[model samples]
Target: MTTAARAPLQLPWRTGLAYGALAAPLAFVSLPLYVNLPHHYASVAGAPLAALGGVLLATRALDALIDPALGRLADRLFRQGKGQGHAWWAAVLGCVLLALGFAALWHPPKDSATAMLVWLAGALLLTTLAYSAVCILHQAWGTRWGGAPAWRARVTAWREGATLIGVLLASALPLWLGFDATSALLVLGLMLGLWSLHRLKLPVAQLADPVAPSPDRPQRSPWANASFRWLMLVFMLNGVASAIPATLLPFFVADRLQAPQWQPLFLLGYFGAAALGLPLWVRAVGRRGLAPSWRAGMGLSVLAFAATPWLGAGDGAVFAVICVASGLALGADLALPAALLTGVIHQGGAGGQSEGRYLGWWTCATKLNLALAAGLVLPLLSWAGYRSGSTDAAALQALAWLYAGLPCVLKLGAALALWCAERHHPTWRHTT
Candidate 1:
């Protein structure tokens, strides 16, 4: 058990809630960058699917590579902030960069396809760098506030729950208010979130002081811990499974379901259910422990999504049910992994100092998963003759198989990895 888990700690309710506001704008920007960017460039700017995919692949690859370095920078800021709050300044700078890059992305000054792609590459790189720094800092902040498993669960839930609200808002706003209004909302939310963060008192880094030293407490890399590696293996497998659906959902709904109008509803249902399920999952964690809770959620998701391939055009309702069930599973996805990671960080003796590094690598894994989903799946779909807005039966069939079948297979792999870790890995078993 972790040191934090041996004693009870309670975050003030208001402070817990206030920090979560930051997740909203972060997520607001994410839905557009990952989900909408490809479709926007492909259809609106007339960039070919292959070319757009290449751009995303290249840019996100670079972005993912930068995460560990950025994470180290976040650690420096945390250490420096022992006397003066340099971390806040860094976070503010990140939010500024995020807003500017986001504006430039949606409203590119370029007109031609090549010019637009160039703009996208530059803007996405800038935005993602800023996003990574801020996210690593924010997550590390929460990690420092850790207590028991239930406390960690509550922290993750508040943040991820707010993230779901942000995603839900992002998905619906583009349709209801259009891109201009949606972009404006993102800016507004970013400003407000930063403001709230500025006012909220953050958890102090107990080991952030440079002058302090415990010669016995050497700082090893987060990767030196075997438990972290096993957790990450499970996390990446599960992440790929989740990201595949996210990448394909718009196409599936528009073409496969023939219910383009239901697009917002599907997104809303998924995110909203995930938000609603967060508390329940947290409660489950309190009873079952993190590993069991997470495995149970994974099992539930495989069963729920297995039925996805059977649904057809008029099955929007069925899909909505699938969305809810799978999204309930999403609550576990969002809450448990990070909560378990907190224990891993505590065990690695990096709780206050190197949490940023761990989260930074976690961020890299996240970006890699999205990049792989887009890089591999998009090009493969194009190669298979599945064009956006195409009504070809063969194309649609290929899409269905890739979208629904592939994720279930990946989920099963992730579940098996989790099982093996539980049975064979002593560190993983003891930590939980």
Candidate 2:
């Protein structure tokens, strides 16, 4: 590395604010797609439950498979000197797809089942593809120009926090303002996204060293990097746990708690707490290091999930507290993993050079977690004799077990894996 190219790293505040503003939308879009889409399709389109699930399952699975390739494209684009503009393009495309997707979702085919399936598949695939591309590019953009651990942490915090704010706002917009308002909120979000894109000061790729891959290694599959695999394994496990409740909370709240009206309260508490908790987790990251703090958060989640089954009907207050605690734990989930992965990228000799490829795979797993939650778990629960509106004690019990116990089991696995990863220094020490 030449001295000129290795000049001291600095944080760009205008760039950070722009980046943070862009995150406001990314955060809102996913929850709606994963959590609300099913109900929306069922009610608005008159689509059958089985067929709707099948379309979402097939299309999203295909979308997840393509994310790595998209990430690779993003990497080349980033290195090709477009900088953060790649994300801007991806965002524009995402916005277009998402708008079309939502509009289709709002007004389905007259044939009901057939048209709904076709529209859902095409629109979701397009929307998911664009969503994945923009998200990967955005993370890569921040990492490329982020400079240091502290700056990267702040960048991630601002983005994730803003994302939570979007989630909270979107939660109310659809309920309070109606679908028209919902569409308007999304359009507003896209505008902020573009404006933020304009605000970013994308760094020039100064290092002559290659940041992308050979033609043979398109997509830059980080799977070949053994350390990344270890980190991914841990990440996937924990992610599934987090995803389970996110996907099922509506069902559980309505059926088990018998209080569907409180759904907003639950989501608000969870996301709002996560936003507040980010700074505290940042403090923990400073004191205990990213790895240790992450493990601690997982432990907190484990305990929280373990305690979930004890709550009964009219337990909204208790559950709200649970959401707050779990979201507090979520702060670590959001902040540390990326920060730790940034360290991994740095150790893998990537960092500013190859964050897109590295983050692409990370983002891939992240999406799959949601896909599995919605596509796999819902059907599996149905197969197991659990229905959303069931008054049967046995069926309701199944919902609780899935909503809490399963996530607890996954999180426990993650905590155990984290312990082993640290002892083995699987990714960290190996890369070192």
Candidate 3:
């Protein structure tokens, strides 16, 4: 069915906030996994860098590979919900699994290096699986509630804004409150977010919903669409650009800046700017289209990163400014692409049925970016005579290049790809 046939989503700010509540906890949990996990495992547990890299690569790749299947499972559960209990039950189960897995991961159950590695692997896999289920279901639910560009942007903004708050909390809490307390907070946030989610009036799914094409019909893969392929290409490159810095930030702060104490300030500057910039980005989407606005963000990011190479030790103040600038760019990064994807789903007439599938693949790409950053980049840095906590000038310079130079190159590539895609596929403008 065409999008015009469906009941339009009219989300007031209150409803949007309620629907987006879960995003905070999800993002809160993510910071430790991406930003803190490798450092913790390496320093605290004493896992060999190469071995740790290999394990992370293998498990995250495995997780990435399964996202599509998990997406399918999420779709089935969503369909089964049909105003029944399937979706709610699945989400609850996912939350329980996530809490258990996260607790085990942060508070390692074993002391021996080998046992710790094994436990880390198992726990990461479980955490990742639960994360995928909840993420795909939530994304699909939002997609099913379709709306106009500004409205859709508002929905995405609320979620992503909450996500920034979560990231801010995660970044700060571990430094001050410690991992144990952080874990407790995550559990609390998850419970509260889930409760808030139930307050949003979700649309009921019909048995033979037109928005969901018949399962029996020959279905074209999401990749079959030119717009999707182009968008995914841009998303992957942009994601890698963002993920590289994320993977390296702690190390950069500890080594290059020589001020580990400033870590929370940097994170706060970045995420706080992102949260504050969401409203401006939503307005930019209303003025320009998604692709153009996203391209603008890319440009801003490159400009911000361009200054990083010159930053030396005790440049925390300068770095904080960079963080705010890049974080403003991050608002566009977080909000626009997801809104564009929802538009793609509706255009394909697969809003209710295949959103999970599309978003599943999207999740795969997202994980792949993180995997490449942690799995490939870290090991490469190790090979290049750069070790974490090293004060060697040469090693610090190398760290700077990896942390700064690489992302600039990737962001430029993403910007170019976005331009090419928009040049050829102009139809996406109206959708955005």
Model 3 regions lying over 4 Å from their true place:
1-10, 109-111, 203-217
Q: After superposition, how far is residue 174 of candidate 2 from its true place, in Å?
A: 1.6
Worst 10 residues of 2 by lDDT: 205-214
Q: Per-residue lDDT tens digits of candidate 3, residues 243-276?
A: 8898888888888888889999999999999889
Error of 2 at 31 (Å): 1.1
> Can you write out model 1's per-residue Cα lDDT over 289-340, one digit (the tens) per residue?
7887899999999998998887778999999999989888999999999988
The segments of candidate 2 whose C-alpha lies over 4 angstroms from its true place after superposition are 1-13, 42-50, 82-87, 146-148, 203-221, 426-432
lDDT of 3: 0.83
| Candidate 3: residue 110 lDDT (0-100) | 53
| Comparing 2 and 3 on TM-score, the stronger one | 3
Q: Give the clashing residue pairs of candidate 3, or none.
A: none
Q: For candidate 3, what is the TM-score?
A: 0.94
Name the lDDT value of residue 396 in candidate 2: 82
Against the reference, the lDDT scores of all candidates come to 0.82, 0.72, 0.83
Ranking by TM-score: 3, 1, 2
Candidate 1: Cα lDDT at 329: 92
Question: On a 0 to 100 scale, what is the lDDT of residue 15 in model 1?
Answer: 80
Please identify model 1 stretches exceeding 4 Å from their true place.
Answer: 1-10, 109-111, 203-216, 424-432
TM-scores for all candidates: the values are 0.93, 0.89, 0.94
lDDT of 2 by residue, 1-432 (tens): 322242122335665578777678765678777777776776555666656667777787788888878777877776664445655666677677766666555555666578668877887777777778778877776666533444446667767777888888877667667666677677788787777777667655332222322334333346666667778989999998998888788778888898888888888888888889898887776566667788899998887668777666898888888988888899889877886676566545565556777876787788788778777777776776776567888778877888899899899899888888887663332211
